[model samples]
Target: MELHIVIEGKKDLGGQLYRQLSDSIRSGRLADGQQLPPSRLLAEQLGLSRKTVSNVYTRLTQERLVLGQVGKGSFVSAPAEAKPRRQLAINLASAAIVAKWDSMHTPLRAPFPEERSRYEFVGGCVTPALFPIDEWRRCMLHGLRQDVKGSGMYRQAEGIAELRAAIAHHAAFARGVVCTANNVVVTNGAQQALDLLGRVLLEPGCVVAVEEPGYPAARMLFASQGARVVGIGIDQEGMLVEQIPQGTRLIYTTPAHQFPLGMQMSVARREALLARALAIGAIIIEDDYDSEFRYDGRPTDSLQSMDRHGVVAFVGSFSKVMLPELRLGYAVLPEAILNAALTVKHLNDWHTATASQHALAKFIADGYLSRHIRRCGATYATRRERLQTLFADVLSPWFELVPASAGFHLAALCKKPLDLDLLLRLARRADVGLHPLSNFYASTPPRAGLFLGYGGIETLDIEIALLRVRDILLQME
Candidate 1:
């Protein structure tokens, strides 16, 4: 066999070797029938110690992965030709319970990028550089230092009292939302918040009004509950409220800047939606997901703030303000539905993690959160401007740049019919990431658009990326 590979020893020696060998197997670089070189000779050739090679081979062989013969040399074992060749698959047939629905098992959790970058413009992530990491870390350490003996104990079902109060105060002040700590419930993230809300609000066969192209997590939750999810079209002004059904339990919306198709709901449409919801006794989920990054002169007051009747559940998150991994988001419920939701929250994970909640509360209360957002918002503003400048110069005249009055991402409407998945693959080969517009839809996919998040990309790099995208689009056209 022939080999062509280079290994870098940056951090951990064992981990580097493990990753290199793991990748070789996964990518089929070392084929099923391939043979490894003798440990001493291979170690000499690769500038590695013979002990290291012997250890690697011994560990792999002890696991029954490779075959070793006394007279004959060791050889790579061929993986069984089954759908999934892992040990679990071999024992699955002998298991106690019947797994009738086995075809759709997902092998992993949420999709993660194959590579890491300081400038990942992921669909929904903030650049860590913008987060007050030092300040937040110090607060976390301090909180732990000052923590009581019961700090590791289960928290109150209502959530960490300080966090709820801080979230309530910040929401009322910044998003024009009105709620008290009693009305607020901390969640793992906006995703879990949606799932919990769906459990409380939706019946198995209930009718729900969802935006045609909306948040994927919400859509999945609604569908999983067997709710009839109806798609409402969006224009420049946001979700057209006219298509909604009367007496519906929920009307999900990202009012500030709609996801994928970034456009704020017009004042008229906002009024119309609230009036309709009030008339039908339906509650509106006012998803103000990314209102903090409003690029326009003045941010509009939220729909929940304007609710005279209790029709809006305002959801806010620190995920946008901080990091995605820190699952901190809150739902400001009206008193009418507060007790019901809290009861469900109490049962569902008992309560949020106390330490994280305490640390986050201090992060916000100490004014670090606001400062980080202000600094990052300005940085994103420059990046957005650079993207706009590049698009104007190179993108086809027919391509439309939809109004993204607020948020890190905006939609780029394509004039031609193109496969978003195929285009995304091509862009990845060019060392770029894209958020396809189709992935947002429940049904009735949009013709073509790209959800370009200008999250943490350096302004200089964005210009070059946009140029590459422009060139790619032109060739595709």
Candidate 2:
């Protein structure tokens, strides 16, 4: 292959080539045993004399960056250790930042397996083909026109007024959340809403209760703020409210659909959860993430709707319903928490992008958002049914399907314990993606199961992916 090296305006052509080639080898851009271009060919390409190129090759050979054979051309040698650019005044080994960070350790988590896997069952992702590209483009153009004509002023830190009004309207009609535009605070995503809550509500050593086998991102967000996050176990009804410890400062729950394990929080349990938060004076964060798409049963009201006292802050996202890249979600706060959360949000990022906010506002007002959800929901329902049927028919011997009525994924509890390590290895061999249910737990022991997400996976490809999964299961047994 021809190496692209420039020898421009340099008096010492041989020295320049030698330095560049040496840097390439030391950086491992040129792998060991990889053949280099012939000296004459490289000389012509770089507009340098052949003799100059030969001298550079000789210099590289002396530095052990390349090997020369009599008949064969030069080849790259093992990478040499790079020299330090400058002398260090302070050693990292003795720095205070290093010692402080050494005491703090964060768990390593993988990105969505779908990024690399062909037949991905990864959760929390939407199919790009389903996005309303043309409509969104028009809305974006409208936003650009508005920006051009409007006065150049810093917009509201809470959010642009139009987008907040649209979100408030959507929440009131769609999810049974009782709120007005004044009560909403726009955030980058639901994750940022959690961070804002943690900032305003949680102090060091504060106790935070969350559903066990819950959204790991929320748990980590709270933990990063130095709050002691205690995991509360859940039954079919939802989080065991009676078991919640007293003196808790904040509580986080996915009431609409308990994440990973999909089940709605029963009405009685919802009332009990509200009562518990009221009694302890703890703030509640209701993540109504995927509540927009329900397939079965009558819809349940949000915990925020039942609060007579200002105890619940409702957070919703367009990541699951619309597109993850939108980076838009809003929190409907009780009168008491709204101002504090807004301040923290301003401190966080000085509000989310205004242009997307304008675009989304138009999308919602023109009813495009509603239409998109309806279209995507119908497609997702069929995929969900196909997966459930596959689990019931072929995989029933080793798995028990969890009752999931909404959202893009399902969980299957193991019938009998199987070596998860061996099963994962077999799955890798079969080229199927699988995530264990155990990874979601923070305190309680994890149950053996799999979380199969269909958002990114195609409807036609579902059967074929499961067939491979079934084969792997049988081979593991």
1-477: candidate 1 lDDT, tens digit per residue: 534435567445545555566556545556665677777777777677788777777766775455676666566664453132244346566454344233323311245656543334566667776777789888888667645645466777778788899998899888878788988999988777787778888898787888888876676668678788888888877788889876588889998989768888888889999998888888889888888987776677899988899889888888887888888888988878888888888889998777788888898899988888899889888888877776676775536678787888878887766666776766777877776677776578465877787775777888667666667766776
What tens-digit string does per-residue lDDT give for candidate 2 at 154-239? Answer: 67778989999999999998988898899988889888888998999999899999999898888878987989999998999999
Candidate 2: Cα lDDT at 290: 87
TM-score for each of the candidates: 0.77, 0.81
Candidate of highest TM-score: 2
Off by over 4 Å in 1: 1-110, 115-120, 149-152, 417-422
Error of 2 at 298 (Å): 0.9
Residue 294 displacement (Å), model 2? 0.5
Candidate 2 lowest-lDDT run of ten:
104-113
Candidate 2 has an lDDT of 0.86
Alpha carbon lDDT at 422, candidate 1: 72
The positional error of residue 425 in candidate 2, measured at the CA in angstroms, is: 2.1
